[model samples]
Target: MQSLLEQLFAGITTKSAEETERIARAFAMLVPVDTTLAFHGDLGAGKTTFIRGLARAWDIVEPVTSPTFNLYTLYEGSRQLVHLDAYRLDSGADLDSLMIDDFIRSPWCMAIEWPERIADSLPEETWHLYLGINDQQTHTIRLRL
Candidate 1:
């Protein structure tokens, strides 16, 4: 049998935002307390939606939104959740200027959207997920293991 991570990454397609969230909730349970998740996808590919699911699993009560403008947002609950959007970042150095580490607490997870913009800044163990939208409007998510 495949490991839990393998099963989750075995190619999942979600027809709705709710389904995507469900998958994220399941994923949140499997990851370590201190980890980073890098989300890769095009516009309207449900990257934020998947992160919303992760927030739900962590019992975060605040709204989870894309930090395209502010660059990042932090939510505190049973565990800390930091959402980062690097679409506008010029380089990994831009990421370093944010001083995100100062805001992070223990047992926290950081979810990065548009991580490619700051690829060099990501930790070696960061988990990467790719999301895509099909012609039928369904969303596909797969792990880059």
Candidate 2:
């Protein structure tokens, strides 16, 4: 069977941060509580922007920001959001120190940035999203199930 990721993001592009967020919000409606997203992209490629849209769709009132300095940030509402940034993490051990499993096993949904930094630690079925910048400064978003 075709996977959800493959169905949702085979080829999608957005012209602005707002558009990206709108698309992300639309997709967020289909996510389950256990869903985990692995986001891959360069800086300013609209990863966080898409996340902001997700938070809005999830009805989270708090702001969404890159967790680079804090490592991870959790937002709570109807359902919890565990935002993780692995940019500074060096290994799976580093990820373990964050007690990532606790979040993964919880009712909360997770969205991880720079997931390549801890690829070994990701859940087997984690959904993958890739964001790229085009010549027109738009974002091209792809997904892998």
Candidate 3:
């Protein structure tokens, strides 16, 4: 069995945003409820696209957009999905002001983009996904858990 401290890294190549979304959908099917996912990548790296797949898997029909200005957005369905964008946040206090702890502790599945900004506030077991652009404008995804 894998130890809690052991990290997992899985790499996959996606030639298009749609492929990236499909990959996210597969991962979505396997994630446990209440899981926290931290996304790391530059802008236009398909972070929101991955979350779009996640939202679709949860049967949420509403459009999913980065809550860069709002900080976070919550979608309700059979399960609650909490999407947080830390792009504009500069400190843990900023995340705290949003009552981030309450959301993390709740049953909602939390997906955070720009997580490095609030790294100290994230749970130890949080899953991390990195998206990078390759030479052909394809996305290379690295998922660590």
TM per candidate comes to: 0.91, 0.87, 0.85
Poorest stretch of ten by lDDT in candidate 3:
1-10
Per-residue C-alpha lDDT of model 2 across residues 83-113, encoded as one tens digit per residue? 9888887665445678867655455678998
The sequence of per-residue lDDT tens digits that candidate 1 reaches over residues 6-121 is 86678788899998998889889998888999999998999999999999999997888888678788998778999998888765455568888887889999899989888887
Instruction: Give all candidates' CA lDDT scores.
Output: 0.86, 0.81, 0.81
State in Å the error of residue 120, model 1: 0.9
Per-residue lDDT of 1-145 in model 3, one digit per residue for the tens?
6321232254777898888887777778778888889999998888999999889888888999998679789998656899999888766544567786665444578899999998887888899998888855588788787
Best by lDDT: 1
| Clash number for each model | 0, 0, 0
Question: What is the TM-score (0 to 1) of candidate 2?
Answer: 0.87
Q: Residue 40 CA error for candidate 1 (Å)? A: 0.3
Q: List the residue pairs that clash in candidate 1.
A: none
lDDT over C-alpha atoms for residue 133 of model 1: 93
